[model samples]
Target: MPDMRVVLARELGYCSGIRRAIDAAETALRSEGTVAATDTLLHNAGEMNRLGSIGLRSVELLSDEELGAATVLLPAHGSTLSEHLGRIASARAVWDLTCPIVNRAHDAVSRFADAGVPIVVVGDKEHRETRYLMEAAGSQLLRVVTSEQDLDTLEISVSRVGVVYQTTQSREFRQLVLAWFRRRGIEVAEEMTLCPEVLRRQDGAVALARRCTAMLVLGDSSSANTRRLVAVAVSACPRTYLIGDAAVLPEVGLNCVDIVGVVSGTSCPQTTIDEVVAGLRQVCPDVRVEVDAWPESVL
Candidate 1:
């Protein structure tokens, strides 16, 4: 077997928002003996398992009985459910770990709703973040567009509409939605709510994927940002693979590849990235792994 070279994407591992939520969960668990979240803290299963091992309890919805005098941590994607918020208020302590970026999107939706303008959300309809925005928009939510087909099916009753997007939505998709609105002569009140860290990771993945023989995207499949990374990488490098961790490296058939690129989702932990690199080395004994420098903001 020939020696292989592995290059890592510049922006890999947990983004600022996920890191903050995890830190808050840990801090609450240490001080309060137990911490509970209304939903999974993040999309990564491995991180969720790690937190669960340390007194982090996840519930689909907060109940007054279960939350009695317990500390509650909100998910990073934010929630607009009044019932959930009301239940959380009764807790002994509440840590709102909603990412600042997500909060901004919520605010944008509220503003549009207040103005009686129909809101068009550009994102996955089933994603928690998109659901939050849709609920925030209430009766004012005009449509949720996940694809060009959705836009084609859209029937806008108003000449002007407000647009907000899921924080983890792809930039290209947002652009497509915006352009669709423009083609129909609809005035758009747009809020660019995509996460900066996610954008950086997507850009880095595309760059690395173009040059590598195969690409590996590391993160849970359920994560929207992680799945977007895989989609973007595949468009540039068709041989892209989405793996939860290094355990699946053997199944990926990387032995014949001379160059491989690695990129991770925002919720992924650095330890997972390290494990993938180590696994690559084991697969190709003479593999040379190179990691890009981390941005100071992430450091």
Candidate 2:
């Protein structure tokens, strides 16, 4: 019998921004006495659990008081200016791990809003990223929605519109949004704010799954990028499953399959992927584990 050939997408795992965020968090945890993160380090549960093992804790950006010798780390997702102002008033020092791309999108909100463009952000309203964008735009009201109907439901009276997306949103979603405006006879002036990491990861996942009989994704269920990876692979490869860890790998007639592709999301730690690979190797000892030859990066 041929052992399964296992593969991984080129652009799987943590991106550069997440790497920086985790690094800053670990540094804060190791610092003497006490340090505070304006909020959770990242959205990944695995990463958050790892941080919890250390001395760090998640503090609301709204939580402010006198801090004697503590370092306050602004969220990598970037808090609103108002939140930063509140934190700046008392923290000894601040470390900002905000991703450069995310920063640009934030800056655009105000720039476009001031130019009389109605701002419509495509992301979850409750998310910290979207919240910060709303704050930066300084609008008494803003609209946040996910689907086409959500866009049509908006009562925005402006003729011109400024559009931006959640950091990890799919390009297809954005395209659909763009097309919607065209059909409605409204023009959108969008910022160049697509998430490079998500685009890269989606491309990689699609490419890698094209050849594999089955695909497996490792990530937290709540992670948008993680779920997006799964969706990307599944669209190309019919057999795809998103697993939180290695122990969840389905062994249903594994002896019948010739190959499987494995991948992880930006929020996933490399260590978790290694563990999954190791576990699967134990299950299918002869499985050929490989990575793409094209290219893969931290994104």
Q: Per-model C-alpha lDDT, please?
A: 0.86, 0.76
Candidate 2 lDDT over residue span 205-266, tens digit each = 88878877878888888777788888878998888888788777655334435577887877
lDDT of 1: 0.86
> Which of the numbered candidates is closest to the native, going by highest TM-score?
1
Judge candidate 2 against the unseen true structure and give its global Cα lDDT, from 0 to 1.
0.76
TM-score of structure candidate 1: 0.93
Which 10 successive residues of model 1 have the least lDDT summed?
290-299
Residue 256 C-alpha lDDT in model 2 = 32
Model 2 regions more than 4 Å off: 60-66, 140-142, 250-256, 294-299
Residue 40 accuracy (lDDT) in model 1: 88
Which regions of candidate 1 are displaced past 4 Å? 59-66, 292-299
lDDT at 63, model 1 = 57
lDDT string for model 1 (82-113, tens) is: 84657677777777888999999899999999
